[model samples]
Target: MKRIPRETMVFLLCSTFYRLASGALLVSLTWNILNQESISYFPLALAILCSFIPAFVTPTLIRRLTRKFNGRQMSARFLLGLAILTLVAGACRYDTSALLVTNLFVWLLFLLLEASLDMWFTQVQRGLAPAQVQRLSGATTASSQAALMIGPLLAAGLTPLLGNLGFSMMLTAIFLVVAAICHSAGQPPITSNDTGSDTKAQELPLALFIPMLLVWPTLGAFNFMLPVNVMVQGWSLLELGILDASFGLGMALIGVLVIAGVSGSRLLAFLSGLLTLSAAAASAWLLLPQDLLFRCACLGLLGMAFGGARIQIRAAIAQRLDEAAVGRSVSRANALGTPVLLVVLLIQLGAIATAWALPFLMVMLSIALLMRLALQRSQPHSAAPDATPYS
Candidate 1:
């Protein structure tokens, strides 16, 4: 794969700043709250739903927004807004009732920022040759995961020292300052209509998009509740940090494997789906009263399956859609799946109320994930032929 330009690297680093802020907040606030069991299924579900709902409209919104502001400017505006909202949320984190309301707004702000980032990065990747997509995606994925790994590690040490509210305040300040710096370093706008075609071109119908969107919910379900369950099961913060780190490690490791031999073609998608089933199976077994080493192995394996599938899925999308449309497509998928993930996670928590249900839910999520892969394979490739390996 060809290397993306140096300008693109700067762009990606700025984009990753938002995630770093999010990771800090999540580790400080969300993880601590889950440890206390103060955040139940209902509130968590509502929060996730609110967070992802914007995905549905983000694509269309970004399409128009990018046309007005260049990718860099749009991202700067998003970061500025996000930084402000995060500060406000941090200020109100102590007020239980008010915090919930603020959290809702925070979720909305993040959704907007994330959707915009997705769009911005998609544009960057689309501009690259087909061979470059895989490398660029891998690099971005590695950068994001690196932030994730660092976020929790920071939280594990800092949270216990500063306490939740104090750490949250710190996080808020960090995000606000970093975002400002990134905004100031924004790049010039690029030409938007690379295709040179006007609105007269026929657009792909939403019906064709729904199946792809469905994959989000399956992933959302895992993201929403996995950490909470691990915390609930009496795992130490350090242990949880390690587990989260393992997830990142698995993703990075699998990305390397893909560069070596994994095909992003249709055949690979089918195999990825079948492999996901094994991940679920391992997760289920771990949930069922297992040794620590065994559980760790399962979690790592689950992350591996996700790593392989995620790269393939993105590549598939990049192949099918235009460069400008890639971000919107990803945002749309994330938006559509948000509610489904929230609802399923809620149900899983309810089951947990009766007993330790992590193992069973792992089994269930595995089934759903596998089904998604199969569905992806059965669906015809809708993307126009492109040389980009990362969608």
Candidate 2:
């Protein structure tokens, strides 16, 4: 793989830190709420769904902000705002309803911040060669896993000392301040494209979005079903943690290939396209005997398939779209995609209501995930003009 620019590496580090802080805060708040006997799933679900639904408006927010600010300035301002919001959330930690409300806004701010940051990254990557783009893209995606694992660990350690809100607040202020500085150091001088839409932004191939859209629900089912399966079999939390870690390991393994900028054979890309691979893994997970090792293997497979597919889709999108349009395109995807995920997750919740229906429901989900492959195949393979390793 080509050497990634130092500026890009530092920018990625900034992005990772911001992601880690946001993830830690959100997870900490949600964990506290879940432990409360008085809180119901409806409110928690609503809180999450509400946080997601507002993301459709992020494009408009980014458009207006970029008119007055560069990506670095936008990131700095938002990071500071998020830090303040976390402090406010700390003040409201004693009130259940207030805490939920605070958590919702905190997530909403994070979403907006991410959209702006992505715009910045899109602008920055424009200076790189295609191969360099691939490396940076993969590294950013791989580093993103920090938000999932390290973020949660941060929440756990901090919660005992300062409580959820306090740790979140402290981390938000500390990490985001540094994130702002790194972001400034890493970015180019404000280009017109940074402050406005690119006139020459290419039209994206929407067909590629199928995998990105399926990404959420596919993973959601995996996330939703695996725990239920573990509990039904009366497994310990340690076993569940191990299974989760195995899945994370699989994701990391795939990330390495992506970062190395490995390419796929045409035959391999065709046979192992996003939907097919995910369905195979999901099916194996649902059908195979519930041996812990087997379940772990299946989950790992699902993670690898999901991560590889997601990277492929993103690389294609990056190849097409430019600054503002990139952010808007992603916002649109989230707007449309998350609703599907919400629906799928809701169905899974209902399916798990009865013990007999667990495996059947999972089978149905695997089938649903597989059905997309038909749509995928129906589309022209030329959908991605650039043949990526992930493709």
> In candidate 2, how many Å is residue 144 off?
1.8
**lDDT of model 1 at residue 359?**
30
- Tell me the lDDT of model 2 at 84: 80
Which 10 consecutive positions of candidate 2 have the poorest summed lDDT? 382-391
Name the top TM-score candidate: 2
How far off is residue 371 in model 2, in Å?
14
Candidate whose lDDT is highest: 2
lDDT of 2 by residue, 266-311 (tens): 3234325434655666677667887989877876666566565555
- For candidate 2, the C-alpha RMSD (Å) to the true structure equals 5.0
Task: Compute the lDDT of residue 146 as modeled in candidate 2.
Answer: 40
Taking the tens digit of each residue's C-alpha lDDT, what string does model 1 give over 289-366? Answer: 645555556666666665555555554455455545655566666676666666666676667543233333433344
Q: Residue 146 in model 1: shift from native, Å? A: 2.2
Q: On a 0 to 100 scale, what is the lDDT of residue 34 in model 1?
A: 47
Per-residue lDDT value at 19 in model 1: 62
| lDDT minimum window of 10 residues, candidate 1 | 382-391
Query: What shift in Å separates residue 319 of candidate 1 from its native position after superposition?
Result: 4.1
